[model samples]
Target: MISFKKQLLLSMIYTFILVLLFQSTALSCTTLIVTPGATIDGSMLVAHSDDNHLIDQRIIYVPAMDHQEGELRPVYCSAAAIDEFPQYASFFYPRINATDRGPGYNTPGFPQSIPLGYIPQVAHTYAYFDGSYGIMNENQLMFGECTDGAKVQLDPKPEKLIFYSSELSRVALERCKTAREAVELMGKLIDEYGYYGTGETLPVADPKEAWVMEMAPSPDETGGLWVAKKVPDGEIFVAANQFRIREIDPDDPDILFSSNLFEIAEKHGWWKAADGHLDWLKTVSLGEYNHPYYSLRRVWRLFSMVAPSREFSPWVEDGFTRDYPFSIQPDQKLSVRDVMMLMRDHYEGTEFDLTKGIAAGPFGNPSRCYGPNDGQGDVGNPNRELLGAWERPISVFYCGYSTICQGKADLPDPIGGILWVGLDKPSETLFIPFFAGVQSLPLSFSQVDTAQFSRDSAWWAFNFVSNWANLNYKAMRADIALMQDKYELKMLELLPVVQKTALEIYQSNPDLAREYLTNYSTQNAEFLVKEWWNFADQLIVRYDDGMFSEPKKMAQQVGYPQEWLDLTDWSQGPITYKKRN
Candidate 1:
């Protein structure tokens, strides 16, 4: 028999534990969802920035698998996955085998026998494609996710068997074919196995359709509750580490969700029938409103860029009542170039522009260095003082990897999907296209360790060049941009030719088509890396110590902005008439 005091003490301890768990697993990421009609080429586009606090940003490729009926599969989690399940160590190795060889069947085994351990296995698995740290199975079913914290109690408690978000994504990518299928598959999995990580918003897209699904674990700790809304054909939607889905329409064929989404919310007292339709964002959100300066500002910035006519204030004080629609009709149809440029936006020409102030330093660099608790503190807590911190822009410098994924319905799946990946900040790195059907990834794109600087790694190569340009950003950015535009334009121009050739070959021999694409992807990636290395050398020589080094050209001197000079309280007066005594 337990005493009343003992019971009370245990309850308090459990509450404290939940609080700690929620704080540790908080994450920030950005995603952009565009429907077919919003795009110039009638291709659905989904862009994601996997931003974290200094995690390795290597591109992981999981080859399609064909597994036997009874074979067991191992599930591993990312380093951040440990926060939600502290009992489990971070699985450092690749979750799926890079090669096709399974465990027991190596070298034509003497007898097919199961290993002496209990391992979980799915009933069956399918072939799929993955790129830019996200999954896009061979079916051209692509998926990307952003993390947004939910109610603290909804977080997975300690020592529970659950699936991390990344693991769930990998499984769905491997198993499902379309956006709707992936959403339903993930929902089913979460219901049975339970979701273990922080809240997440996944933008799942196929060649013909796109859906943004917001998910968070239920407060009952049984499983996750989710709601997915389809992006209308002619609309565009963006999410920046925040829930964007508003009302629910269960009867709508476009909107698919967990069966118990509203039931669980009502059970937790987060929803009411009188609220009319179940509001996923309002019901599941961690309840930080009135802090537009936090995550909401990024949403505002994106809306302002795409639909300037539809006014959205970054300074909105109300939290749940934000008038920003779930999706908006863009001012004009967008191209791949327009979407890529949007990924590189930093609120230029707006009041929240990170580049115009003294924080940008003398070179007009929009990048700002973030410390622990710098921008995230005010997200779910509006009372926290901002202290005039620089706005969190889309093209941040510390992103591990960013991708612009395109799914086109007009062409064959192999020839349609393209993953335009940038190694670092989109503004600094070139988006080299990797076709979906490529048989092999470029060596330069694989096995990157961000901690060590290696010339062979594409990520390091671009980072080296971008870091050098940052030194004399104001002076050197124009040259870099020129090179960027030239190379990217060349790739774009060559795409049609490559696609036509590949399509003709695919009609004859799909294998031959894949081989052609593999060679093309590898060649372009290797060439881009080689060119970036040369560009880095040129930048060093041209902007050496802030002076031009061309033999025939005079050195170009640059000065601080007059506003900056005035703010420093320094004099621009001529040298004193009399020498200082």
Candidate 2:
């Protein structure tokens, strides 16, 4: 039997250990949205380093329309379309849409065909050109997550192939003089040959601004294939796993984009003749069953936060299902900040949030689930819990056009129009501008793999800082915020200085530029390590129950909430330094 004081200490230790264990077991990745718009040229390409260390990059793209029969090729395309095509597209284009085997068939039988020697397979792959990888092009702009309406297939054409590269629109724009001609040509190509990825709805700043097209594969198609619609001007759209461009307005060139919506529907007799506003997309394709529940919640969350006037709550379910306004015209033009926030949003302050109180609220912690409190839960149906770690990673990868422009040949160097792909984990990753014009990177950035705990890599720095903060969320969140503020300011201060110095070196000596960027990377890594250590030290010293006694201050350091203040008694039981045997 333990003494009363010892028992109290043991209880506190046990609770702390349990919570810490929960935290360790609960962590998972978050979703992020990349918004790099399309470019006519294939110069700038950027993607998040999937390895998390930012060493190995993930390149994604839509295969060229004409090259469907050739060897396997990859291209960057839209986000929502990709999700829809693989995870949800099949739900729409069922073979039952055709003759004989109709709706009652249960499973939609779609066909798969590949031209040339290219055998189709699905699983994420690196988007690349020639051989080398890492953002080496200036024209590679990848914008994703254009929330559109639902898609369905009244008549399934399993043999029809599709393209998914976002650049198809831009390619059309470059070939055509006006937007109308561009849309027409794009439609023709898509109608003749299907696409394989999400179409990019490009709005570029240039001699020609075009909207790229994209589409999803029919249920019958092999592993991976997507199609895109011919983009029309003056008719803006939104997308979130649902098809956006539905009907083909052949006469109204200003209000359509697709290979041939009317032609295809007519050929298959999928569209209704009598209609006030015929949603051909719904007629030919499929709409989200739980539009509000699964699809629009993301958009509603964004619009609610950025443009309150257009706000729609996920919890506010009404009688009318599809009656809610579908498309929203932003009161203001989209900006980088808007894109960034959308990518980082976690349904905070909403009903859908998976992390509010461990039950099924929306705080959506990426690491752990709420039910059972224990780490392990049902494996097959992880979604039963409030927060599903495996289900949703915290930050989704973001690929968007930066205001900067650079040429392709110069991308091998980080300074040249190098791609700006990055992990969208807020306060954890920095979007350091890599210009096509710059010559090199700081040493701190490149030389990081060697660092250990004492020696910190940029990857390790963020992991340590974020994990340390999570140790006592009630206390450490503030410290984490404080750390972010200081770190960002420091980065802002250092980047320009580093940029200017590196530019000067590049002009004087190009070789020096490479060395400079590499060094800068290292220096940036070092700065992060130094700051993180200080923050971690504060956590260790303050929470150790030796140098400090005030549980409130400890809470402050770890970022605990006010409600947890009562829990302070747990920390005050007694400081035990005994190591677990």
Candidate 3:
């Protein structure tokens, strides 16, 4: 028979496990938007950080294709899709190897081809020159997404149709040439087949314009309800796991949405004609507005960074009163580097800075290894009860990958678009430029093994350096940032020359231009990987343990911060040892 004490302990353990399971379902991602006029180089920019803990992400290159008439394209669901929509038995089929099948339907890591549905194929699919989590086609069109879950009753109904946000983004990239066209196509597809993902925000951009669209599953489980708002030139927008759109102007040309957007809400009793005007966010949001810490804090952090002069408080008793605009015009034009820096924000110098307190450890690292208390609560000790709150900074260490895509109208499509990509934590990794005309991806950028270390893999290399720096961040970050600046600045400096040369080659032969751009991208990636390895070796030797090793001199001790020392109880700490004679 078990003791009473054992029974109590078992009960507590079971409760913690339940809490962890609940928190794991929360979606986390951030997307930043910039209009062409808001950027210094006249490029529309949209950046995203895929902060999901599962990190097997790698760069994928999908070449353009031309199909004959009477051809049909099969749609397959990924492991993520299956996990997200378990009710759809089709997505849960046995995994198949891409090696066993032919081309045109497979994606890297998503080898399992469980045919979910089929869509009509276009006559000609543009080249997948540059791409990220979503898609970017040869015409300088790109899409980025952030999950903003809707009300519980609005969970996807798999029986109607099956196109998740990712698949929709993919199809749009293949079929559409402009931002408006993509938006129209997406609306048509979602309306006809239905949308099957959680609430999502997609920023679709071309060389000339960009639009922010928010879509949610229909309450009646029939289809999707959505609204797309165009970001005017010289303005910026951002979304971080929460709906940002407030009201809609149905007749406005800049606003595009489903015909049943308001009808569905009214039919389901989610809204009423007596409510005056339809507010999409108020009606469709998952009701997370009352919880500031989970989502609103991120929105506040982003707004504060882009427009510091504006008074935005991270903490407020009620979020409804906080009238933060959907988009804002910056005081000055932003640069590509500025967007990259914004992706690396950690709420520094703000009241919510995670690195400033005792929770940051003695080394002052801004990052936390995992979610609060591993999503568990303590019942045995009241003092140990899980707070379950951590600052959701843009540049967290566990991010799978992050991307900044630039679409410039002034240049040719091949020379205009640039996808700046980084693996792991954005703060620790360098953003390498991948032009839209590049033909092939480097081997280092295509590594798939996330479970084990590989010296040849770029993701592993950056993770290695980042993990080490987290050990003594305050002391070692200077060295890491110095190297980061060196590589990033050099890449920025070479951009103009690269574009000019590619244009010159394109004037005579376009194929030659593609080859040159591809070679330049591959070579630059290889060089960056080699440099990171060298820097890793130097870091290992320079900061081993708690000492700083000099090249030709004795090592120096690096101690903890004075504030950390002061917080410790050290009344009997000074232990004196007798020196040996």
Q: What local lDDT score does residue 86 receive in model 2, on the 0 to 100 scale?
A: 21
Candidate 1 residue-wise lDDT, 455-518, digit = tens: 8889887888778877867677788778879988889899989999999999999989988988
Error of 1 at 579 (Å): 11
| Total backbone collisions, model 1 | 4
Q: Which candidate tops TM-score?
A: 3
Predicted candidate 2 versus true structure: per-residue lDDT over 1-581, tens digit per residue: 77755753564465345434432222111112212222223232222222122111112211212322333432222221222122222211120112211122222223221221212322322221110012222233322223222232212223344333333443432233333454455455454555543222232211123233334433333322123343222112334333444444456544554434444545456564564344544543444322223334544555465446655555544312342343344455443333433444456555545444543212123343323443332121223443323223223222111112222333333343333323224434434444433233333333223113423334344455555544444345455556655655666466557666777787878767756765565455455556665666666766553233355554333344444444456455546876534
Judged by whole-model lDDT over C-alpha atoms, candidate 1 comes out at 0.70
Each prediction's Cα RMSD? 7.9, 14.2, 6.7
Error (Å) of candidate 2 at residue 43 is 19
| Runs in model 3 lying further than 4 Å from the true structure | 1-26, 78-111, 129-132, 153-159, 289-291, 371-386, 574-581
Estimate every model's Cα lDDT from 0 to 1: 0.70, 0.36, 0.72
Of the two candidates 1 and 2, the one with more favorable TM-score, higher being better, is: 1
> Higher-TM-score candidate among 1 and 3?
3
Cα distance off (Å), candidate 2, residue 104: 49
Answer with 1 or 2, whichever has the higher lDDT: 1
